[model samples]
Target chain A: MDVNEKYFKNISNRERAIFEGAITMGALFHQFIGTPINIKSAESLEKSIKTAMELQPCINKVEIEINRDILKKIENEYEYISLTGEMLDVKVESNFSDKSAVIRLKYISELKYPLMYVEDVD
Target chain B: MDVNEKYFKNISNRERAIFEGAITMGALFHQFIGTPINIKSAESLEKSIKTAMELQPCINKVEIEINRDILKKIENEYEYISLTGEMLDVKVESNFSDKSAVIRLKYISELKYPLMYVEDVD
Candidate 1:
């Protein structure tokens, strides 16, 4: 059977925000908190995120952005990163005219610290 | 655990279109076949669609519109409706500026026939 025919079964659209956020966070968690974060780790995280977010209905494309160098630095300093302790700020926005929905997560109050933007194409 | 934390674990966003289309189709199938088509059928289809779609990430709202009378008319004459026989035309459009994605399915060739539009808000 086709993939579409198998999934997207019965969830509500509003809940997608949380879904996307969690996906992005999972990617970030995978990229960081590892044995020395690197560019490859970043790429892997973004790839995972890209693959995950695009699975939603009405989402034709997904674009992600993150600063790997900064992320690596933060990861090295901390023994572990906790995503569940309100550690990250998440935002979900849809630009109708642009035909895209952006899911972003920010860590650290500093300017241009760590941000992940997942854009969905319809 | 949260819904987002639980679901949206794994799935490519691009596949989401197919995922969404199938969900919409399922709803349509339920509303049209083996019964006297009515507004409730359309409502059920749209509602199912909305609930299913909103479950995706970055989707804030879902708006659905369908022609019930037209669908009911088509149902009265046909013994069985074949959806897999290249029967329906599906259109998925994203208006980024408007922050929405519109999924429309048309069954008839006329100017106005059985059409289902499921709009997603992010």
Candidate 2:
């Protein structure tokens, strides 16, 4: 089916279940493989999702938000991709009062394991 | 005071105040400067305290925990000292089930700033 046609086709309950299953599997793969995996430069989220799907046949889509400060730090310090799926949300706040930086992660869903330490790419 | 003499000097209430002041100042300096500042390999904790004291009149001593797995990753990836005073505690757990790594940090005592993203020196 064409992309639009497939998307417009009213998703059945069974199809939805299957899709949820895939996401669950993706979450599982992500749990096993590790989070914040490098999907930044993989053309598009669709492509990245595709890559993830190829690995586990379950992930249908993906979302990402790049922290420029983190990206800059990573670029300045290291040469590896920084990725993590276990990260539900991230907030970077620069403290002018104290002249410091704070990175906070709130409520990472499906974090079956403890937080994994990923090196900044800079 | 000689080493033993100073050691035996019963810590008075006033002296305790002074010491607490120093720790509070160290905590402030740690806030202004950033956390996890490199204190390792400065000879000893006393030396580390000395170094911090030199930088700021308020600081007295410092504490640190080195995560070896993180150390290895840092060593393998880049070259910089990994330090964070804001880091109150650290727990590193190897995930045999998922074949991954997990690093957890408990509450940091006097974190005046947001979390400083420090590069790990491997």
Candidate 3:
């Protein structure tokens, strides 16, 4: 398995205290779960957000910004969800976008220091 | 559940790609798993290292440094394994020591950037 798969599997089991505590943190840590950003069209974007909310009810807010390149590439194929987190900001890139996508997630707890950014960089 | 427990549980599953990838990273990411540093006496320290080897056969090298305060506190009960990682150094403190214990682990892979320091800071 690749690093990405391993990372996801590590957090797959909620039985672990860390995973459970992350959930208990609620919207502060549980705010993410939006639709795949590579898709074009307002309907696809809406569907992604809707699907995200269905999986995670704690997500009260979601803000997505699609660039013109991504808006154009929706007609083709996307390779990966490129993600990068530096300092505190998250930047994402993919074959589907001319410009990178940025998402910011903030929390109230101190545990936030360890997991500051998560990008879908493919 | 506390954040500590949740974090551990999330990574408990080997099925996740990230967890398995960490394993595949081998000594680069698998250098840790030594005897708990809080243990006192050369015998206990030896035992901890021994137990660590048994759990992770891939560990080819391990260096340990015990200070005077930790050596002295071995006679009493301690509370936690305080650990801090900043920049590149790792500092560990516990009820067992007057001075903090420090350990550094390095690797060859790029993923090393993500997991900088992991102190037993219980």
The sequence of per-residue lDDT tens digits that candidate 1 reaches over residues A5-119 is 2222333443343233333343333333333334445566556556765553444445555564445455545443322212334443433222444455555344334334343
Candidate 1 CAPRI-style tier: incorrect
lDDT of the structure predicted as candidate 2: 0.34
Indicate whether candidate 1 or candidate 3 has the larger TM-score: 1
lDDT of 3 by residue, A1-122 (tens): 66535654553322232332234223322232222233334445544544553343223334433343534443323432211111112212112112222224332134423142333322
Give, for candidate 3 chain A, the lowest lDDT window spanning 10 residues.
A82-91
- lDDT per residue, candidate 1, B1-113, as tens digits? 33223332343443344233333333333333333334445566556656764553344445555554445456544433322212334444433222444455555444334
Docking class for candidate 3: incorrect
DockQ of each: 0.02, 0.01, 0.01
CA error at residue B75 for candidate 3, angstroms: 33
User: How far is A63's C-alpha from truth in model 2 (Å)?
Assistant: 4.2
Compare candidates 1 and 2 on DockQ and give the better one: 1
Q: By TM-score, rank the candidates, best first.
A: 1, 2, 3
Candidate with maximal DockQ: 1
Query: Can you write out model 3's per-residue Cα lDDT over B1-122, one digit (the tens) per residue?
Result: 67535654553322232232223223322232222244334455544543453343222233433333544444323422211111112222211112222224332133422232434322
What 10-residue stretch in candidate 1 chain A is worst by lDDT?
Answer: A2-11
User: On lDDT, who's better, 2 or 3?
Assistant: 2
- What is model 1's DockQ versus the real complex? 0.02
Give the poorly placed runs of model 2, Cα more than 4 Å off.
A1-19, A22-46, A54-69, A86-122, B1-122
Model 2 lDDT tens row, A5-108:
67625854335434434444335333322122233542353345435533532233333343334434433222333233333332222222212222333323
